[model samples]
Target: MFNLFKKKANEIACPMDGEVIAITEVNDPVFASKAMGDGFAVEPSNGKVFSPIVGKVTSVFPTKHAIGLLSDSGAEILVHIGINTVDLAGAGFDILVTEGDAVDLTTPLAVVDLEYLKEQEKPVTTMVIWTNSEGKEINVQLGKSNAQTVIGKLK
Candidate 1:
C-alpha cells in the first residue's frame, strides 16, 4: 500500500565532473569536521558548477564562491567552490544565478577559473553540503562523476 503522508526522496546530482570523495576527505577543517553539515566534495576536472538539487536559491555569496539552495524536500544545501577561494573576493568566479531563483540539476550555478585557482594555490575541491539536516538521512555514491550523475539522494 502506498502511503500518502510520506515525503518523496529527492535526487542529488553531481555539481561538476570529477572524482567524488568523502566529505571527511575535504582539506578544509570546517568541512572535514562536518561542522557545517554532511555531504561530498569534488575535485573538479573543469570549471562549470551545476545544481545538485531542485530547489530555490537561498543565497549566493557576494564573492561568487558559494551558493545556497533550499531543496524542495526541505534540505538546505550549500555549494562552496574551492577552498580559501573566498579570500580572492570573486576574482575568478562567475555567478550565473541569483537568490530566489528556482534551479535544477541542469542549472549552471557558476563557472570557476581552474587555472586561476591553481595559480593562486587554492584547493579546488568543491563541496556540496547540507547546512541544516538534523532529522534527515543522505545517501551518497562516491567516485567519478559528471554534471548529470546521480551522486546521492536526500531522504
Candidate 2:
C-alpha cells in the first residue's frame, strides 16, 4: 500500500501580525534584493515579535534592534525590528531573550515602541530573513500572517 502524505519538517510561524510581503517589497536593498537570503518582510501591525522556531538565540544586538536565532532544524532567522531605527540607539526596542537562550515558536523575542519609532520617523516594518536560505526550497506563504500562523517551513 502507498504511504500517506507526510510532513518531515516543522513550520516557521509568523513572528508577528502583519501584512506579509516578499523581501523585494521591502524598502531596503539588502532585503529587497534577497541577496542575503530568501525570506520575507512584514509591514508590522504591532511591535511585539515572537520566535519563529524552537532554537537558541544566536545573537541579540547591543542596539536591541535585531535578533538572530538558529532553529533545531538549522534555520537561521534574523528579526530586524524596524527600518533605520537603529539610529534610535535601542531607544524604542526592548529585547526579551538574550544570547544563547532557548526559544520556541511562541516565545516573545522583543517588544517595540511603535509610537516612539513613529515619533522619530522610523518605518516599523520588520524583516524575517533566513540568512542561509540559499539553494533551499523557500516554503513561505505571502500575505497576512500572525504568531499563530504557519507562514512557512525552513530547511
Q: Compared with the true structure, what per-residue lDDT tens digits does model 2 show for residues 1-155? A: 76453222357878888898888899888778988778888888888889877778999999999999887888788888888977988898878999999888768999998899989998888888889887886678898877647777875
Q: Which candidate is the best by TM-score?
A: 1
lDDT by residue for model 1 (16-93), tens: 999999999999899999899989899999999998998889999988899999999889999999999989999999
Q: Residue 110 CA error for candidate 1 (Å)?
A: 0.6
Model 2: number of backbone collisions: 0
| Location of the lowest summed lDDT over 10 successive residues in candidate 1 | 2-11
* Pairs of residues at least 3 apart in sequence or in different chains that clash in candidate 2: none
Query: Clashing residue pairs, candidate 1?
Result: none
Per-candidate Cα RMSD to the true structure, in Å, reads 4.3, 4.5
- The TM-score, computed over Cα atoms with residue i paired to residue i, of candidate 1 is 0.92
Q: What is the lDDT of residue 72 in candidate 2?
A: 82
Against the reference, the lDDT scores of all candidates come to 0.89, 0.83
